[model samples]
Target: MRASLTPTDAPLRARLLALALAVAVLAAVAVVATVRAADRAAEKDRAQPGEPAAHAGEVTLRQPGRLLFRNLAWGPQRDRVSAVPLTATSGPRTSAPRDCLRFHAAAGTGVCLRATGGVVPGHEAVLLDARLRPVRAFPVPGTPTRARVSPSGRLVAWTVFVSGDSYAGGAFSTRTAVYDTRGGTLHSDLERFAVLKDGRRHRAADHNFWGVTFAADDSRFYATLATGGRTYLVAGDLASRTMRTLRENVECPSLSPDGTRVAFKKRVAGASADAPWRLHVLDLRTGRESALAERRSVDDQALWLDDRTLLYALPGDFGADLWSTPTAGGGAPRMAVRSAASPAVTG
Candidate 1:
C-alpha cells in the first residue's frame, strides 16, 4: 500500500544507511580501546619484582636529593643501596653493592655498613661521597644491623649485634658506635657513656645501646638503651658523653623532619611472640605519645614521609613492602611502595 520511491531517492537512502552503520562501528571500537588502555594503566601501577613502572620521559630529582635504602632482594652478602628519585615515584636506580649489608644516606653523603664473612666474621663501615663513590672505609665489630648518617653528612652511626648479653632465647645485645667524618674520629661503643635513669646513674653491665638517631646539630643524639630486662629511650650529648633516659618501652627512634616528634616502635607486653611491637610517635617537647593506627608488630625503624606522614616496612614472604601512615595517628595504613626495606629519604 506504500507509494513507490523515485530511483534517485532510493539510491540516496541506501548511501545514508551505510554511513550510519560505519559511524556506529567506529564508536564501538573507541569504547573498546578506552577500556583496554585503562586495564594497562592499572597493571602498571603495581610494579613487579625489581621492575618499576616505565617513566614517560627523563626523570630528575625535583627535591635536589634522592631517597636511599637497602635493597633486600640483593641478598645479605651482596645487598646494595636503592636510590629512588624524589620527583619520580617509580623505577628506582641501583648502585654498586660494595659488600654493604645495610645503608642510609642524607644530605649529599652516604654510609654503608659491610659485613665480612669467613673464619674471622667481622663488620666494617664505608663512607661514600655525593656521587655514591667510596671515599673511606674502616673496620667495625659485631654483626651489622643499622647505619645512619647525620643530616649534614658529617656524622655517622651504626648498631651491631654481639653475643653474651642476651637472655636465654632472647634477642642479642647491641653495640652502637658513632664516627666523625671530618675529624677522623670514632666512638667505638656508646655503652661506656654515662646512663642516667630517673636522675640517677644506671650502673649495669647488661646496658646495651643501639638504634642511634642524630639531631641536626650532629652533637646531640637519641638511642634505645636496654638494661635490667627493660628498654628505655635516652637522649645523649656527644660532647658530654652522657645519655639521660627519656621514657620506657621505646626503641628504634626516628626523628621527624621538623624535629618536633619521634616515630618509634613500642614493645608491647603480653602480645604474641611473633608480633610484639607497635608503632608509636612521641612528641619530643611535650613527652606525649600517640599510637599509630598500625597495630601489627613493626620491627624496622620508621621513615618520615613529611612532617605529617611516616613510611615503614612490614615483613612479607618475599622481603618487605613499604607502608605509610599519618603522623597524627588513627588512620589506616596504606602501601606506598613494594619490596623495599630500611627506607631513608633525603631532605
Candidate 2:
C-alpha cells in the first residue's frame, strides 16, 4: 500500500515532478548535441572537392614497383591501405578494403595496426595476406605507433605507446611484440629479452623497447631500448631471446636493404624538446654515423626506397605526407607522396 499526499504535501509532489521533467529534457538535449557533433566530425573526414582522388580497388603485396601507404586524402577511402606506382607516387590511388593507422609490408605479408571502436576504445594488430585480407588479429595493449613485416615475411613486429606521451621527459611506457607469422608464435614483450648492455648482462625495471626492424635472416633484428632516461640501439636475436646494446640516443632504427647500414632518428643536442630527433644513418661496418640533410626533425622509422634513399612521413596539410632523402647525407628532402603515410615498397 502507498500513502496518499495531503493538500499541504500536494505542492511538494508537484515540485518534485517538475524537477524530474526538467532533468529528462536536459539529458535529451545533451544527447542530441553529442550526436550532432559526431555527425559533423564524420562529415569533415569525408573528402572535399579538390582533394586528390582515390578509388576503391585491389591492393596486393605481390605488385612490384608499387608503393603502398595509408591514404590520408580524406574521402570514403581515408585511412585505407592505398597503392600507387612507385615511380608515380603522386598519381591517383587505389584503396584497399581495410584500415590501418600504421602499416608495413614485405615478402607478401602485411601488418596493419588499427583502432577497434568498442565502448572503451581498443586496438589490434591485424595480419594481412598478399591480397590484403585478414589472416589473423592480435590484441594490442595500447595505442599503436610502429609496425613492420620482416624482409622474408616470416616475422612481424609492432610497438604501442602504453603510458604517457612525453618522450623527452621519460614519461612514456612502450610495449613491442615480435611474432613468427608461420604458426602464430608471439613474443609479446621484448622487455623479456635478456639485455646485454655495456658488454655485460643488465637488468632494470625501467627497460622499454620499440621500433623493431628485422634483418633478412628474420631471427636477427634491431630496435630501440630505453632505460635510465636514455635510448640505445640494440641488436636482437630471436633465437637467443637477447638484445645487445650498440649505440645511444638512437630511436626507430630501419635497416638497409643490403643489411650493411641502418637509418634512425637521433636526439641531438640543442634541439627543441618537442622536436628533438633528426634523420641519421649509421654504417654497421665502420660504426660511423652521419646526419642526413633533412633539417626537419624526422620521427618515423624510415622505409628504404632503395639502398640509396630513405622514405619517411612528416606532418602535412592532409594529416601527413611522405618524403624522401638521400641516405648518404647529401640531398634535399623531396615530397614523395601527398596526404599519405606509412609507406611500404612492394616488389
Candidate 3:
C-alpha cells in the first residue's frame, strides 16, 4: 500500500529531475571542451607540407644493431640517403631523393635536410628509416644546413639558414629546432632558451643557434649561438631549457665519442667564409683548444671517426669531399669518401 504523491510533491520531483538533466549537460560540455583544446594544441605543434602531418602521435622507430653510414657521397643517384657500408670500397646507390643538402644517421634512424634550390626555395626535415624511407616530414623555414640524430635515436636536431643579404658580407641568420621523437615534442628555435652570458641573463632579438651536438645521455647538448655580432659555443640543458656560453668563436660543434672533447670550426682572424675555417678540438673539462692539422678550410661540422680521428668535408670540383684528420693534432688530411658533404657515424 503506497500513498499517491500530493500535488506539491509532484512539483518537487519534477524539479529534481530537471536539475539532474542540467548537471549532465554541463558535464558533457566540459568533456567536449577539453577534447577540442587538446586537438588545437596538437595542430599548433605540427609543421605542414609533408604528405603525413608532422605530428602523428607516438611512433616507435625500429633500429638495427649495427647501423651504417650515409653521407652525400653514399646515397643513390635519385636519393642521396643511401646507406653505405663504412668498410666497403663502393656500393650501389639507392633511388632516394638526392635533394638532401645535409644528413645524419644513428641508432638505426636518420634525418635528411632536403632543399628545393631555385628562384623559389623550400626546405624540409625528412625522418628516415635505416633503409632510407621517409617516415615523416616537417617543413623547414630556410636552407637546410645541419642535421643530427642522437645515438639512441630518441632526439633529432637541425638548422637552416633563415635570412641573409648578399650585400651584407655574406652574413646569414639561422634557426634551429630539436625534436623529441619519443615524446612527440618539438622545441623550435633554441633562442627561446634562457641564455646566460657570463652567468647573467642575455637578451637579444637577433639570437640564433646552429649545429647542435647531443651528449650520449641525451640530456645535454652543445651548439653555436650567434648574437651581438659574435658567436659562442653554448652548453645547453634540455631539461632546464637554458644555455651557458662556454667559449668564443666556436661554430659547428661535434661531440666526440668519449664526450670529453668537441670538434668545431674556428673563425680565422684574416680569413673569410669563402676560405677554409680552421678546425679545433676543445677539451671540455680542461678548456684546452688544439688545432687540427687540416689546412683546408673546413665548412662542414666535423665528425668523429673514432676517438683518434676526425672527419670533415671540403669543397671540391666534383662537389664536397669528405676528409679525415687526427684529433691529436698534426696529421695530413686524407680523403675518406668523395662527393660527400655531410658525414654521420653510427654506433
Residues 1-347, model 3: lDDT tens digits:
99999989998999999999999999999999999998866654443332111111112124222212333332124224444445642443222443477788777678888865589878899888765678888889988778888878888999988887221133788889999888888998898899999999999988989889999998899999888777899999999999999999898899998899999998787776567379899999999999989976777788887899987877754466678899999868887765555666555
Candidate number of the best TM-score: 2
Clashes of each: 0, 0, 6
Candidate 2: residue 334 Cα off by (Å): 1.3
User: What are the TM-scores, per candidate, against the unseen true structure?
Assistant: 0.77, 0.93, 0.75
Tens-digit lDDT string for candidate 1 (153-245) = 889998877764322225677778899988988898998889888999879978888888889998998888888777788999989999999
Candidate 2 per-residue lDDT, tens place, 1-347, comes to: 99887898989989999999999999999999999999977975678777778999988999999999999997889999999997778889999989999999999999999999879989999999999999999999988899999999999999999997546667899999999988768999999889999889989999999889999988999999999988999999999999999999899999999999999999988999889999999999999999999999887899999989999999998799999999999979998999999999897
C-alpha lDDT values of all predictions = 0.76, 0.92, 0.75
- Prediction 3 TM-score vs. true: 0.75
The TM-score between candidate 1 and the true structure equals 0.77
Q: Model 1, stretches more than 4 Å misplaced?
A: 1-65, 74-78, 97-99, 117-119, 164-171
Residue 112 CA error for candidate 1 (Å)? 0.7
Please list the Cα RMSD from the true structure of every candidate, rounded to 1 decimal place: 19.2, 2.8, 16.4
Candidate 3: give the clashing pairs.
75-82, 76-94, 78-96, 79-96, 79-97, 276-297
In model 1, residue pairs whose N, Cα or C atoms come closer than 3 Å (at least 3 residues apart or on different chains), thus clashing, are none
Q: On a 0 to 1 TM-score scale, where does candidate 2 land against the true structure?
A: 0.93
